[model samples]
Target: MHSLARRALHTCNVPRDLTQVTFCDSAGEHPDRVGLDGNAAEAVWRSVEALYRTGVHPGIQLSLRYRGEQVLHRSIGHARGNGPHDPASLPRIPMTTDTPICFFSASKAVTALLMHMLSEQGLVNLMDPVSYYCPEFARNGKRTITVHQILSHRGGIPAIPRETPIDVLWDRDEIWRLLCAAKPVEVDGAKVAYHAITGGFVLQRVLEKVTGDTIESYLDRYLRRPMGMKWFTYGIAP
Candidate 1:
């Protein structure tokens, strides 16, 4: 019965051949340019291959640099289809080195950096209460929450209210309204609860209030363009 079940499972959900899904930009790899021997580079790539075999990530991209030169730039797996539960008929989209992926929580680092930049410019004081910039944030007993507290995950507004719809994340105005209206879990900055999504919107409001500009425009002008980043915006353009 065990052997029969194994056969049935394999027949129903056949694993994809890794070679069939792997894609690489041959021109982008230049180990010799960085003085890295081919064997060493291949060894590193083999580790990435091992990770891909684990089936945790649907897609993976690697751009390793050595001595300021690109030694390996490669990608593996589908960007869209080929999930373990996906139907075989679903069309697969190859995850290329150029494919754009969501940075998610990684963007918090950029947001925090921008806030520090604002401080350096004398536009904001990290220790000051957020209400000092955007008075609307003072609603719901959050008047004392400082910008530094928010950046450090002590803003007291950890998760959004349980009743808030998931769709609110995409609606800037609605999300801001909800965050402003929601009450805090605590306000002394004595706890270390993660803000998750709330701190970002709060920080954004403070930023926009002080700069008189949208965060997206600010990021593009100050960081993305200056650094020649191809895709580092808040959202992908449709």
Candidate 2:
């Protein structure tokens, strides 16, 4: 096997054959989706390589899958930049198969899935009042708001006030209190705008309270363990 192919398989827990990568479901049942996109994958990788030609080298990695199989894997750039050749004072990054970078956003869909399961098992009613479980939630005009409002981005409370201490982020109740105390800008469900950052925490608390389970515990017991995927994070990992 090519060294890059070998490296990608080892790091990504995928099979060696980039041409036809498929794996049996861990649930011991049917196959999920599988395969690779050749042309589009080439276009994406070439675009990244083009950026380096412009002297704007950035750490870049691309992974593309077709159906469910990974067909393209490319990592390029440096943790630090390459000197003057860098167009700045950074060291040039030589792309390798396994360098880490952080990207954010998309916990919303995962949180939504959690809600789906909750609704599925009848643990909570999405359309029911938030105050039904969190009495303080009713303090402001939020008394009638539903978990569905929060999940769908229909919750009036969008951006948290500026400079709210970062330390308070991981505390669900603290964030919940802020949300409850704040006034809604919209009548629940009139229009939905992206919550950006604050939506995740706000929805998280409602989910936690209604189900009587911490988000961590809920994710562990229901989603992660069930699907066998571990892609959750609230803060710095130990």
Candidate 3:
């Protein structure tokens, strides 16, 4: 093992109870069935530690696997600020291996995977126009915009207007209506620009339309539940 992995292995605070490790198979009961490079695994942990030490992030929870078998799992640091939510704060609630962290834009990739699953089930087609699943999406000359374009960042509707109320984001109906009625900034599929938040909203509606279920429900039934995840969901319920 590399020095990095050795240090990580020696210092890692793996919880005593196997059940406390999130994302571990059988709660980390089985040994490695396939050989994994201890050095490489250690390097991954060292990198996370270095980032935390450098103030890049306050804490990290990482899990690594090889050939479908977990090789290394570690979690370290605080969940929040010790001082008010200010820069001067030190550490607060200690983060555990199982602490639930928000994915933010990382959730986009998850949504994309969900879309692929729906496509594989033959309930949705990437090549089809967005309007095929949600007819309101056809407004403002968007009838020609394909799901493929949206996923690829070529749909041309990148942002809702600046005049849109900030609070409207939490109101799904208002956000959906704004996106459906909004015009493309350029010709659809003519260019590539990150859609940021708009793509997710449109995709959510499309997925719900095809699956007859919300994105959260579809993920729970097909993804999270099968994987044995206890708390993963699209959003926390109010």
Candidate 4:
């Protein structure tokens, strides 16, 4: 195995007992919520505890709602500084229910939902090529890639080129330019390679082009603000 892979495996093999030391419970749980009994809620929490004991994840947070009421809102382990590979001398930052965790790929689901919502509003048709909305994406033989293909991980451009700088991610225009210029592995939507980070930008561009607004503003106006979310955003606020 590669040295880094071996190190990663070793780091993930945390002792079961260490979970107890690292565990931090949030005070936000509402076991007494009318439909949920304390015992039933504890059963669910115990299941979460069992997963935590496996030590694969350094931290976890859960907010489970039952019938429109939040029955469980809790977190466990360290958000930082207590990874299995870290030395014991480091100070642990306790994971809390309020911790600003990155949704990462989970944001893709939200983006997908937004796309469906846009379709419902007659903003863009899912089956239409993305180039129909953002003509720049038509470059480099991507002219026929549909919004649906991108949403489903079938759009051919799965990743940015290896030679690209990591910092280019924050430069939206530059990243889009690279994506526009990238050759597709295939454009027939016959494969299932995941786009990972690339699809989000493509979807964002289409959304912005159709709405004449930034994706963030569109999300805020349609979903975040209306849903009363405190911090479900693309990036952390400074």
Candidate 5:
């Protein structure tokens, strides 16, 4: 391991109370008694605990699994915040292994998986032009762009203009129109600039157009529901 990695691992010291951890098993066996190397497993726990103690990150919940067995499960710090540390001040909810946390841009993999599932089911083709499903995407010289290009971050529209309000990113129709009307920074499939957020909106619209269901609904039916995940969705209702 590099010095930096060693330093990080060494610096990660969790509070004594935070050390309470659990392991999930099929036959209700303890993780240590199951088959993982004790040192390796301890390292994973220490690393996750250390991340929570970094102070840069407010909280963390980490679970490691092998062959369908959760070998290590742990949570540390407050999901809300440390707050006043007094019961009278405010309620500081401590984070737990089962806490509902948002994945943010980490959600890209889930979105990508959804697209792959669609392709696997023969509902869409990765090689087909995106315009085949969402014809409006053909505007602004993007008629030649392929689904593979978008998935691989080669679809020219990595971002909307800087002046775009943060709120519009969630306004599906406005964001979609802007993306469709915008010109590519480079030729389709010629460069690999991660779309960051733009590609998700565009691809989501195309997905909805093709499947006749909202992206959220599609995910629930094809991914989350079957997998037994309840809280995973595009947005939380406030």
Candidate 6:
């Protein structure tokens, strides 16, 4: 395990979660396709073992969709713990198709999608001032900020002050208070900077007020359940 990981670390930057590790540096051949006529099972297990030798691995599923049909579906690596070793001290914990894994910040793209859909459907005007929808949000100097600015991450309070207590972030009232009092470090809508984490939460509240729906229900009814994408959330799932 140590030797395999040494090679992987030297070759690639596949960051591992010490408490929750997954596959490291999953790679493929240059041929673009792996034949599965016979010995397919052996090939799949070989790929799994190759990953285990490196370090802790996660289940990685690769599928090819063509003409509305899935031509190839491959599962590589185990879920959590080291499974079993081939000729070593450990074994490989093989992964199955039904095993669902946490898809982290990829979840935010879904939130962005919800905003896009609302814009396309004419339900939410992108230019509308957040203050227009949520009058209470006009406090401080934020009265003029637009939904476009917020979603595009130009809304004033881009940089939440560093001294904010990390524990209070989940406290809705405290979080809003910090954001409400924050001053914009950059001019709104000049150039663009990724507001990273703060923009999403602010947009969430504004979204809820305008649609008369929580971000989850608004996203799920119009985005997830309809679109058949279930691995989505704005915050922790209820």
TM-score versus the correct structure, for each prediction: 0.75, 0.60, 0.78, 0.81, 0.75, 0.64
Could you say which candidate leads in lDDT?
Answer: 1
In model 4, where is the ten-residue run with the lowest total lDDT?
Answer: 18-27
| lDDT (10s digit) by residue, model 5, range 109-204 | 888898998888888898898899889888979898888888889999898999999999768889989988989877558889989988788678
Tens-digit per-residue lDDT, 19-112, candidate 1: 7777877887888886788999889988987777666677888877788667788888878875666665889888898888899898999999
Each prediction's number of clashing residue pairs: 0, 8, 1, 0, 1, 12
Candidate-wise lDDT, in order: 0.84, 0.62, 0.75, 0.82, 0.73, 0.60
Minimal lDDT window, size 10, model 1:
6-15
Stretches > 4 Å off in candidate 2: 1-57, 64-73, 82-89, 94-98, 120-125, 210-212, 217-232
* Model 2 lDDT per residue over 1-238, tens place: 3435434443221223322321212232211334334455567656766654443343555555455444555565455543223333444445454454444676678778887788888877888877787778777687877778888888777788897998777666688778778887875589887788767776676677777777878888875565444344343357
Q: In model 5, what are the clashing residue pairs, if there are any?
A: 12-50
Global lDDT of model 3: 0.75
Range of the 10 consecutive residues with the lowest summed lDDT in candidate 3: 16-25
Better of 1 and 6 by lDDT: 1
**Candidates sorted by TM-score, descending order?**
4, 3, 1, 5, 6, 2
Q: Locate the minimum summed-lDDT window of 10 residues in model 2.
A: 22-31
Q: What is candidate 6's local distance difference test score?
A: 0.60
Comparing 3 and 6 by lDDT, which wins?
3
Mind giving the per-residue lDDT tens digits that candidate 3 earns over 103-146?
88889899999999989999899999999999999998899899
Q: Put down candidate 6 lDDT per residue, 133-227, tens digits, no spaces.
A: 77767777777778788777687666667887788767766777777777666446775767776777777777776688888788778755753
Off by over 4 Å in 3: 1-31, 35-40, 82-91
Q: After superposition, how far is residue 169 of candidate 4 from its true place, in Å?
A: 1.9
Residue 107's lDDT in candidate 4? 97
Q: How many residue-pair clashes does candidate 6 contain? A: 12
TM-score of 1: 0.75
